[model samples]
Target: MAGYTVIDFETTGLSPRYGDRIVEIGVVKVSHEGEVYDAWSTLVNPQRDVGASRIHGITAKDVLTAPTFDDVAPALLDAVAGRIVAAHNASFDMRFLAAELERVGYVVGERTPPSVCTMRWSGAFLPGSSRRLRDCCASAGIEIVGEHSALADAFATAQLLASYLDRCGGRPMWGDEISAARAFRWPAPRPAAHTLTYKVRADRQPERADGWLDRIVARMPRSADSRVDSYLAVLEMAMLDGYLSLHEQDQLVEAAQSSVLSRPQVLALHAEYLHAMAAVALEDGILTADERSELDRAAACLGLAQHDVDDALAGAAGDDGADGLVISGISLTVGDRVTFTGEMRMERSVWEARARAVGLQPAGLARSTKLLVAADPDSLSGKASKARSYGVPIVDEAAFAKLMDRLEASAD
Candidate 1:
C-alpha cells in the first residue's frame, strides 16, 4: 500500500448515520517508498450547527463562505481513486466520505479501493499501548501542525504510517506471513446463539422528561446559570427528538410572545430546536412544505436579537446532508423478546427494565426473539457469541447508548 491516500475529516458530530455533516477534509498522498507526493485540504460548508464548538473549535464563522461538499466532491474522489485510503479511524472517515460520495452519485461497494484503519491496526500490533493518533505520532516523532484541522491530522497520520512501514523494512506486507495476512479481517468471528432472561418490576419507570434539564442545571457553572433552566431543558429535549410538530412551533412562538423576561431565552431555545429539527428532516429526505415553513418561522424568531441562535440557524441551513451522528432511545412494549448474556454488575431486575423501555423481549436467542443485549459480544462463551453464530443482532452497552443518542437526536 505504498501509493496510499491518508485522509481525515473534521465533522459536525460523530457518526455519519445520524445526520452529522463533514465540515472540513484533508488528504496527503504518499508513494510506496513512503515519499510524500501531494497534499490537499478544504473547508466544507456543512450547512449545519457546529454543535459542540468547545470540542472542535470550528464555528459557522469559519465556514461561512467555504465551498460546499458538492463543490469538492469530484476532486476528492479523484485524489483517492485507485489508492488505499488510510486513516487513524478509517471506518468513521470512510463511512462519512462514502455516504457523501453516494449522495453525489458515486458508486462505492466491495469493488472500491481497500481502506485501512490505523486505529484498528495499532490495536492489533501495538496492543496495551496508547493507540490514539496524537500519542502514536508523539512516540514516532512525527510533527503535527494544527491538531484539530483536517489537513494537519492527515499529514500526521501519513507520518505515522511511514514510521510503521520503515520499522517493517519499508515493505507493505510481512515476508512469509503475507499470504495468511491477506485473509485477516478485524472484528473477527460471527455471533452465536445463547439464552438470556431477566424480569420486569413495577418500580421501573420511564425517565422523566426533565431528566436532561436537571443534569444540565447541575452541571452548569454559576456564571452561566439562567433561571429559565426548566424551560430550556424541555426545549432542548424536544429539539433532540424532532418533536416540534408544526402546531407545536406555532404554540411555542405564541408562548414566547406572551412572556416578558423569558421571551428571548424561550425564542432562542426554540430556534436552536427548529434548526436541529430541520436537519433531521433533511436527512430523512422528506421535509414537507409545512415543516419547512415552521423551520423558517423558527429562524425568523432567532433574527430577533439572538445572535447565537442565528449562528446555529446558519449552520443548520448550510449542512451537506451527510452528518454521521446517531441519537437513539429505548421504548419497550409487551411481548418484545430480548436476551441478556454474560456477567453484569447491575441487578437482573434493572436490566429487565432497560429492555422493556426499548420494547425488547427478555428471552434467549431463539428464532422467535427480537434482539439480544450482551455484556461482551466478543466473549467466547457469552450470549454474544451464541447470538453471532445464529446471525442475531447483538448490541453492547456502549453501542446501545449510542443508538439511543442517535434515536433521541433524530426524534428532535
Candidate 2:
C-alpha cells in the first residue's frame, strides 16, 4: 500500500506526435500512510521556441540556462523507476514521457513503472460536471497553487490521490492499473539524481561563430537563446567550409552535451539549419554540384536524414524564376500582415524578402498576422492548430505567391 508518485508535465503542446515536447516536470511521492516522501521539479530547456507561451506563461528567458531533457532524463528515470506514476491526465503526461524516453533510446514499456490517471477516477470522487484539473480540485476543495506549473500541479494531483484513497478506506486497485500502464512500456532508464545545477557562463560574450552563419543566426532574432547560440556556433563552423571538421565536430558535440538538448531538440535544430540552407539554395538559380556537395556534408554534420535532405531539395523545384506558373487572383496591399507554416516552396528569409519588396509586412508565427501561408492547410503543427483556433485564413503556396505578385504589381 505504498503511496504512488504523482506527476505532471508542462509541455509545448498537447501531442508529442506532432513534435510537441515537455518543458517542465514535477513529481510528488506520497507514502502508503498518506505522508509525503519527496517532491522534485525542473524546467527542461526544449532548445526551441517554447510554444503557446501565453497559455503556460513559461517564457524562453526562464529556461535560458535550464538543463535539457536528456540531462534530466536519468533523474526522471530514477524518480519513477519503481514507483507508480500518477497524474491528473496520466495518459497525456505518460505519452510525452514515453516519447522522450524512446527518443533517448530507452525501451519504455519493459523498463518503465506503472501509471495512474486521476482524471478517470474523477467521476467516482468529484461531484458535478467538469473533469478539468481546476474543476476537480475545486470539487474536492483541494487548493491549486499555480495553475500550469508542473510542481504545483503534481502536488495538487498528489493531494487528490490521497483523497481518493481516503474515500476507498482501503488499498485502491493500484496493481492492475500499474500493469495496464506498463503495457505502454517506455524506453530505458539512464542515471538518477535528485537535482541538477547549471553553471552560468562567466564570459558574457560567450563563444561566437565567425563564419557566414553569424549573419544568418544573428538575423534570426528567435535563435538568441544560449543553447541555440551554441547549436548555431557549431553550424557556423560547419558551414564555413561546408564540412564539419574533426575539431568542429568535437566542439559541436560538446556544445550539444552542454546544452542538454533533448534528442528531439537536436533533431529540430538539424532541421532548422537544413531549412536555412534550403531557403536560399536556389536563390541564385539551380543548386550547383559544389553547392549540392557542400549541402550533403552539411546534412551529414547536422545528422539530418536523407528524406529531410530530399525535402529541402524538393523546394528548389518551385524556383522556376519568371518562367514559373503564377496562380493569380489573390490581392494584397502594403502593410498587410502575413505569416507562414509548413515546409514552404520558399525559405522564410526569401518569403520575408519578397514581402518587403512588395511593401507588405511579414509576421512571426504567433503574431497577430492576417494570413498564414501553409504548405498543407491540414497540417497538425502548432502554428496551424493555433491559426485554426484563432480563425486565421490559411493559403497555399500558390496563393501566397500570387498575393505577393499582385502586391508587387500594384506597387509598380
Highest TM-score, which number?
Answer: 2
Q: What tens digits encode model 1's per-residue C-alpha lDDT throughout 204-273?
A: 2223343332322222211011122223332332343333555445534433332222554454444444
Q: Cα lDDT of model 1 overall?
A: 0.53
| lDDT by residue for model 2 (1-412), tens | 2447888888776556557688878879976555665888887888887865644567688787888887888778767665677887565577678788777677765333457767656645664424457667877889987666788888888988888888867566455575555454334565544457632212122122344433333322122122343344434534544556565565555556544565665666676566556556666667777667666767887777667777767754554321111121123677778887777777878998888887767887654676788786545577866775565656667767766765677778
Please report, in order, the local distance difference test score of every candidate based on alpha carbons.
0.53, 0.63
Error of 1 at 250 (Å): 28
Question: How many residue pairs clash per model?
Answer: 54, 11
Q: Estimate each model's TM-score.
A: 0.43, 0.46
Q: Estimate the TM-score for candidate 2.
A: 0.46
TM-score of the candidate numbered 1?
0.43
